[model samples]
Target: MAAELSILVVAGGRGSRAGQGLPKQYRKLAGKSVLARTLEAMHAAAPAARLTVVIHPDDQALYAETVSELAASARAALSAPALGGALRQESVRNGLEAIGREGEPEIVLVHDAARPFADPGLVARAIEAARAHGAAVPGAPLNDTVKEVDANGFVVATPDRARLRAVQTPQAFRFSLILAAHRAAAAGGREYTDDAMIAEAAGCAVHVFDGDPQNFKLTTPQDFARAMEQLKAPSLADLPDVRMGQGYDVHAFAAGDKVWLGGVAIPHSHALAGHSDADVLMHAVTDAVLGAIAEGDIGAHFPPSDPQWKGAASEIFLVHACRLVRERGGMIAHIDATVVCEAPKIGPHREAIRASLARIMGIDVGRVAIKATTTEKLGFTGRGEGIAALAIATVRLPEG
Candidate 1:
């Protein structure tokens, strides 16, 4: 369906509480500005909707820097930053007026850009509700104890929490109703906390739908720190070190098989069968190399169907991975591999395997360490049903 809605993102607040010199919306979160993530959420919610960001005049440089760092697809969707007014309401009115000059939308969504974790589903539901019922906003039912207090620290009475709801945006409304409401509020000097409150005071019924708790606004320095922590933890789990990558592979042993454990062909009574030679060590190492560059898994790059790879020696695959890392401006730091099996005492051949892999990868033997272990007659590998190999590769990229 053709979306006839424009998103007016109110991001111009000075954010005095955050105290980072930059507005809270422009603060870094997960290596990118919070506004960028908010914009991403808005676009994901409504891909076709026109997005207008209201930014403080002083924040133009900060906004530009943040948008420039975003992916091409995200940057392309952004319109130039429009200067906001003295208040958030005025800022939103400025954004609405600009969108009005472009083309009057069927509906408009006014949102706070500090809430980066807004759910796309909730936004969609809010828009649909507004389109059908005239105006709508997402809200979570208040579940905390409510107390009413007077000035001078006097407790009056406890209100019912069940009767209250904590509101969030994108607060949706018909274009005509919201524009007129904002104009009236602006003319009457009525500055409300949220757009829905303004609409409610203007005799407009604002429907409320359930919203997510994760959509809480990032308002404090601590909140920014938490977001940064979340981003780094996931990336760290995926990468142990700049000079190390780890991998593991396993295959079952069947009758009439030529065992290819590593890149080296080991003459055996049976052979491992799979999409490829099923060289556990090579597959594990290939994955480690790819992981270092954040490139993806081996299966994503090389599928089993390619005619050139049928029953191909796994060494060729390992060489290709090494070349890929080098091409991407990275060097192998070190790699440690281990083989597991009940039979085939590989302790004597560890040095040979290490030297062979080091030669193939064009690295020193010391940088490549290989070891073997037995499963102690426990499971599949322990029962001599198959062999498994684990590899860890350390790679380094030049620091910019």
Candidate 2:
């Protein structure tokens, strides 16, 4: 029963101390935000865990923008952020209260959004330790000698270094007990720097487990710089796996007033006939993207036999193909598509088609190329009986 877990990521602080224009947790790190990586680590460690985030109320737009970089699964696992208070402790309390409204969790992991290097293994260790004990925190042994200082800035007591532990978050606890502790603290008009103290005040025994030195929190601009240096992606062009794929599609014309092409509806004397809207250009590009990822074709993803996809806007297919590429850690370097038709005059709408494709694919306009061609009385397109499209996609994948 205690195995069911919930994790709360605290990202409410403005991070003004970090000397960044954005919150430290929202700043880019290793091609992703610190909070994104933090959420990813927690999800990887406990796939079954429910996740919640706490944020400053004014940061809704910023939060939305930052979370877009997360993987789809991680984003889906997250609950809407609980509006935070002025202090870190209050913010975490708000998150806890919000998570309570959902359901009671057996185990709860309270994590700092600024620490992105806490990997799944470390999280697992903390979870195990917490389940064994009433509460537990991940901490590393002190490498520096410690001394207690007074208000005069003079050493009052020199403590043994062996007993000192620098605790880090993803502090784990029994949900009920920690919740009770936080509520009690709030009622008493008290606040602590971290959740462990609340547990300690509530007479719950908290244990410490081995922690990674790399799981350091970003506190200032210098700290962020150091983290960037540690986590930045190095030169990887040489190790990349580049791939190219091609697709071709043809659709016969039927009487209609307009036709959909590359997500844009253009006035035409006839519309393409197919199970879907038969945006010939979109079908070709989608197939090309899927092929580049070695993931079959558009037909596999959007089967014509399924009633759900009947008369579907074909842009859905292209979006799916693009998402597949992203899920595989691949990106579209370029997508070049050619339209073949003897009528409808594609020359008048070439740029519009390209822009539409770029929007659907979530790529830049420069990366999407659309051109028009004619069979010149050589085939069906030459006779105005149908339209054909050919697409070539270039993809870049990370090497193993």
Name the best candidate (by TM-score).
2
lDDT per residue, candidate 1, 73-181, as tens digits? 6667666668899988889888888878777889998889888876555676677678776888888988789788999778899888887888888889998888888
What TM-score does candidate 2 get on C-alpha atoms? 0.58
* Global local distance difference test of model 2: 0.83
How much is the lDDT of residue 85 in candidate 2?
96
TM-score for each candidate, following the candidate numbering? 0.57, 0.58
What are the RMSD figures for all models against the true structure? 16.8, 14.9
lDDT score at residue 185, model 2, on the 0-100 scale: 90
Q: How accurate is candidate 1 locally (lDDT)?
A: 0.76
lDDT of each residue in 342-390, candidate 2, tens digit only:
8888888888888777756657899988889897788899998999999
Off by over 4 Å in 1: 1-3, 229-400
Model 2 segments more than 4 A misplaced: 1-3, 233-400
Task: Quote the lDDT for 376 in model 2.
Answer: 76
Scored against the true structure, residue 242 in model 1 reaches a CA lDDT of 71
